[model samples]
Target: MGILQRAKPLSNIGAKQVGFTLIEMVTVILILGILVVGVSGFIIFGTRIFVESSSIDQVLSQSRFAVERMTRDIRNAVPNSVRLRTATGGSYQCIELLPIDSSTSYLELPIYPDDALVSGTVIDNGISINAGQYALVYPLASNSSGVNDVYQASRNKRFELQSSSSSANVLTLTFTGLAQFAEQSPIKRIYFASQPISYCFESPIGNSEVKLYRYADYGYIASQPAPSQMGTAVLMAENVSNNLLLEPAIKLTEQNLMRNAIVHIEPRFSVNGETFKYQHQVKVTNVP
Candidate 1:
C-alpha cells in the first residue's frame, strides 16, 4: 500500500508537467496576441509619422524655391514694368514683368527725318540682336518736365529686330502690333534691350488644386489684357493656397523714377488628412 501511494503521487505530478490546461493555453495565446497588436500599432504609427514629415519637407522646399525665383525676377525687372491683374476669367492672379536681360547704345538713328521709322531703323551691332528679340528705345535726354521720361519713352515702344546688317554693323527693327513712335530728334543718345517675364496661377479642370506658372520670352504687347497665355509657360509649383482674398498678392510703388513691389504668397498642401501652410513675403526693387 505504501509503494502504491508513492507511485500514484509521482504519476499525478508527471501528468501535470506533461501538458497545460485549456484555460492556461488560452490565457498565454491572448497575452501573445496583445503584444503582437501593440507592436504592430507602434510600427504603423511610426511609419505614418515619417511619411508625413517627409511630405511636409517636400512642400516647404518647393514653396521656398518658387517664391525665391519669383522674387529674384521681380527685383531685376525693368522699372515700371511690374503689373498685377486678374487672370483665368478673373478668377486667378497674374503678375507681368519686363525683365531686362541686356542693354546697349544705339549705333545710329533711323535714316533721319523718317515718319515713325517704318522699317529701316538701325541699332548698334555691339548689342546682341537675335531674330525676334524684343527691343526698347530709351533716350538719354533728361526731361526738364520733371516727369519719368525714360519710363515714358520705353513704354509702348517695344520692338523686335527684323534682321541684322552685319556688314553695316546695324540691326533692322520692326514694330509689334500697331506700335508706332513719332520721330524724336534726340534718338541718337538712346539705349535698347529686351525684357520679358510673367507669373500666373492656373486651376486645373475637375479639381480644386492650383498651380503656379512662369512665362518667359513673351514679347512686349501693347498691353497685357490677358497675360496667362502670353508666352511659353513653365510649372513652378503645385497645390498653391487660395484661401485668402488674393492668394498671391502684389503691390507696386513708384518714387523718383524708381519702382518697388511687395509680393506675398501662401502655399499649402495636404498629407494624410493633415494640412500644411507656408507664408512668404518678398520686396522687389527695380532699376531705372
Candidate 2:
C-alpha cells in the first residue's frame, strides 16, 4: 500500500561532461585577434589617405587663388608702373604696381618746355577724380631717369589732383600746384592712379616657410619699401619655396612697339613633401 519514485539511468550519470576543450577556446581567440587586427588596419589606412589628400587639396586651392589675384592686378595696373625688387641676399622678393583709377584722352596738358599750369582739359568720359589721386602723363617706365619715371614725385611725370569739373563734353582737372608733364603722350592719354600696391614673398629669419603678403595704400616712395616699412600686410599664401637667387618670383617685360608689357609670375608652393609651381604670364592692356 506504499507509493514509489523512478530513479536516474546509470549510463547518463557516468557519461563525460559535454563542453569546449582548451585547444578549441585558444583557436577561437586567435581567429578573433586576427579579425580585429585586419579591421583596424583597414580603418587606419583609409584615414591616412583622407588626411593626406585633404592637405594637398588645401594647398592647391590657396596657391591658385593667390596666382589669379596677382594676375588680375598685373593686367589692370597703370602702364609702365610695374616694378620688381629683391633683397641683397634674395631673402625677399617684391612686385610693385599702381592701380589706375581713371583713364581718358587729354585735350590739353602743360608739357615742357612750356609754362606750368594748374589746370588741364580732358575728354569727359564720366571719369571721377578723387582727392589724393595723382595724374600721370606719358609714364614710360618706373626706372627711367628724371621725370620720365612714374614712381618719382616730380611734377613733370606725376602730380596730385585738387579738383575736377565738367562742361559739355570736356573735363577740366585742376592740379594741386603748377605742374608740367615731361613729355606729351602720342595718344594724349592720361591716367589717374591711387596708392601703390605691393606683393612680397618673405621668409622669416628662423623659419623655412616663405609666405606671400599684400600691401596697399602705403603711398608712393622713390625707393621700394620693405615689408616692415610698408602698410598693413595681408597674408596671401604660404609654403612658398622659390629660389630667388636662381629665378625671380616676378619678372617684367616692358612694352615696346611690337608687344605689350608682360609680367611673368613663377611661384612655388609645397605641402607634405609635394611641390607645384605656376608659370603664369599677364599682359598689360593699356598703353601710354
Candidate 3:
C-alpha cells in the first residue's frame, strides 16, 4: 500500500512538470511579434505626417514675408522707374526701381526752352531736403541704354542737390550746377530720391535652386548691374526653383496712356516634396 501511494504521487508530479510544449510557446511568440509590428507601423506613419506638415508651414510663413516686402516697395516706387532684366542664357533675373524719399510741389523750376538755373524754389512741406539726394522733375520714361533716363549721372529730368534753405515756408533748393528739367510736371510736383534698389533671383552654377537677393546703396549706373556687379547682396528668400530662361521670376508692364504701371511677381518655392507659387500683381500708385 505504501509503494502504491508513493508511485501515484510521483506520476501526478511528473504531469505537473510538463507545463507547456515548444510548439505552444512558439505560437504565442508569433502572435506577439505581429502585434508589435502593427503598433510600430502606426507610430512611424504619425511621425512622418507631423514632420511634413511642419515643413510646409515653415515655407508658407517665409514666403508671405518676402512677398509683402516686395509689394510695399513696388507700390512706393518712383513713377516710370521700374524696369526688369533677365539673363539670356538662364542664370539670373532682376528688377530695379528708384524709391522716393520725399516729394512736394515746386513753385518755380527751370523748364525746357529756358536757361538752366543753379537754384529752384518750392513750398516747404516740413520735409527736410539734404544734399546728395537727386531732385527729379517730370521723370516720364525709362531707356534701355539709359539715354534721358533717371539712372544717368547727367540728365535734364533730374539733378543732384547742393544745398537747401527754408524761410517763411518757401524752400530754396540749390543744384549741383546749372540744371534744367527736360519737361515740367503737369502738377508741378518734384520728387527727391536716394540710391536705386535692385532685387535679383540668382542660381549658383550647376545648381537648380534659386534665391532672392536685395541690392541697395549702390550708386546709379547707366547699365543695369548684374549680381556680381551689385553692392553687398542681402539674402531675402530661398528655395526657389523657377527656370530663368523659360519662366522669368519678375515681369513689368510699363504704365501707358490707358493704364498704370503693374508689376507681375511670380516665384515658385519648393520645400520637402511640396511646392507653392505666388501670382501677385502690385500697382504703382505714385504718379508724376
Top-scoring candidate (TM-score): 2
Global local distance difference test of model 1? 0.58
Using TM-score as the yardstick, the better of models 2 and 3 is 2
C-alpha local distance difference test of each model: 0.58, 0.86, 0.87
**Residues 1-288 of candidate 2: C-alpha lDDT, one tens digit per residue:** 998989966666567787999999999999999999999999999999999899999889988899999988888888888878888877889988898888999998889988999999999998888877999988876444423277777536888999999999999999999988989999899999889899998877666678899999888887777887896899999888887767677788877878988989998888888988899989998888
Segments in model 3 whose C-alpha atoms lie over 4 Å from true places: 1-47, 143-148
13-62 in candidate 1: lDDT tens per residue? 43534678899999999999999999999999999899888887877687
Q: TM-score each candidate.
A: 0.64, 0.85, 0.82
Summing lDDT over every window of 10 consecutive residues in candidate 2, give the lowest-scoring window. 141-150
Q: In terms of lDDT, which candidate is stronger, 2 or 3?
A: 3
What lDDT does candidate 1 reach at residue 249? 41
Ranking by lDDT: 3, 2, 1
Best by lDDT: 3
> Which residue pairs in candidate 2 have backbone atoms (N, alpha carbon, C) closer than 3 angstroms, thus clashing?
none
- Give the alpha carbon lDDT tens digit for every residue of 1-288 in model 3: 355444443445435344788999999999999999999999999999999888888778878888888898899888888878888777899998999899999999888888889999999989888899989987876665545367765667879999999999999999999998888799998999988899999987799999999999988877777878886988888898899888888888988878889999999999988888999999998888
